[model samples]
Target: MIVRPRPNWFRMLFVWRGSVLPVILPQLIGTTAFAILVTVLHGRVFAWKIPLNFVPFSLIGLTLAIFLGFRNSTSYARYWEARTLWGTLLNETRALVRQALTLADAPSDVPTLTARLIAFVHALRHQLRTTDAKADLERLLAPQDCARVQAARYKPAMLLLMAGEWLADRRRAGQVPPALVQAMEVPLGRLTEALGGCERIAGTPIPFTYSVIIHRTIYLYCVLLPFGLVDAIGPMTPVIVAFIAYTFFALEALSAEIEEPFGTEPNDLALDAMSAMIEATLREMMGEAQPQQPSGLPPGGFIQS
Candidate 1:
């Protein structure tokens, strides 16, 4: 994700890094050229006039805009829900660790719990992004624990199970009170719930047929728009068509990019940064040195802005 200060409105017009304009630039150019051709021909096809006017185009454009708006809205909802899940994860992990850290510090339960918590965060992130979690699991987990989690198909769930078993052992050893164990288990349960939510979002996507129909409709609308507008807008059809195409194309591109919020796209959720933050903060809580992230990982926990 591209994080930076919000530019002034005047500068925002040309800001490129975080915008979808670049992604849709090719489509915009093609539509603009096609519009220019239609304009030059005066909505004609070598002496055959294409009978078109703004009437039909107006109705179609309105309907297309509505569809685009609804689609983008749905995509953004997914994006926001994903962010909320991560935020919930950070909170739950912190609560779990905090509860453990306050307990009997003699038997070293804090480190085990903290490692599992952090591992759960990374595992969920990797699973959502469909990336290998071996490096992260090894870096954060003990040999046996890492091996066990690696062997499991669902790593996050495995980590949570390990943590639960750890708590059960703590209670069995009489080091932690039953009441405290039950309280600490709350966060773990919440973590499991959040995991299910993330999995649901990742597994389910915008309907394929809806996406295909909307995609085809948007492009077709843009292509046919020039014919209808050239008859009325005359020489200005290219500019008008380009502007309109830019709007539709940009929205569609943005919707697609953010629809899979767990992706590594520029507009997708900043899972790496977020995971780094969760790890760093938890390490601080456990009094561990803030070590450098492993190779191929981003350095800072904070997203600069």
Candidate 2:
């Protein structure tokens, strides 16, 4: 995600780093060229003139804008949910580490336990992004523990299971009282729920047919738009059509970018930064010094959303 102070109104118009303009620029240019061609042709096909008018385009534009709005809302819902899950992860991991430090009878084991927790956070991010977690796991876990988690197909779930086992071992050995063990399990269970939620979002995507229909509709509407407006606006068709096409094209592109929320896209959640944050927060709780870096989100406007 692009993280910086919001620019002033005039500069915002020219800002490109976090906007969908970069991805849709080609589409916008192509549509504008098509508009220019249609305007020059006077909306003609060889010897015959295409019968198209502004009234139908005006009506269609309104409905198409509404559909685009609805689709964007749906995509934003997924993006927001994914962020909420990660936020829960940060909170629960902090809570669990605090509990382990104060409640566990064996103080020396706290650091090791914290390492496993950190590893789990990194593992979840890698799992969601479909990246390798071997380096992170090796850094945070022992040879045996790392090997065990690496061998599992689902690294995050495997790490979560190990955490539950850690709590169980402490309870059985009389190092952690039964009541305290039950209390610690609350955060662990919340962590598990967050894990499950991330998995659900990663595995499920917006319906393919729905996206296809909307995408097809937007392009079709834009392509035929100039033909309808050339007679009404004359030479101004390309300019008007370019502006209108930009709106529709940008919206569709933005929706598609955020629909999967776990990607490496500019709008996707800052998983790498967030994972580092969890690590830094946990280390601080364990009396380790860590300098936290900023991983701020973009503005809430639809253009950036």
lDDT of 2 by residue, 266-289 (tens): 888778777877888888888888
- Runs of candidate 2 exceeding 4 Å displacement: 291-305
What tens-digit string does per-residue lDDT give for candidate 1 at 153-251? 999999999999988888888888988988988888999999999999999999988789889998999999988888677999999998889888888
Candidate 2 global CA lDDT score: 0.87
Please give the CA lDDT of all the candidate structures.
0.87, 0.87
Q: TM per model?
A: 0.94, 0.94
For residue 179, model 1's alpha carbon misses the true position, in angstroms, by: 0.7
RMSD of 2: 3.0
In candidate 1, which residue pairs clash? Answer: none
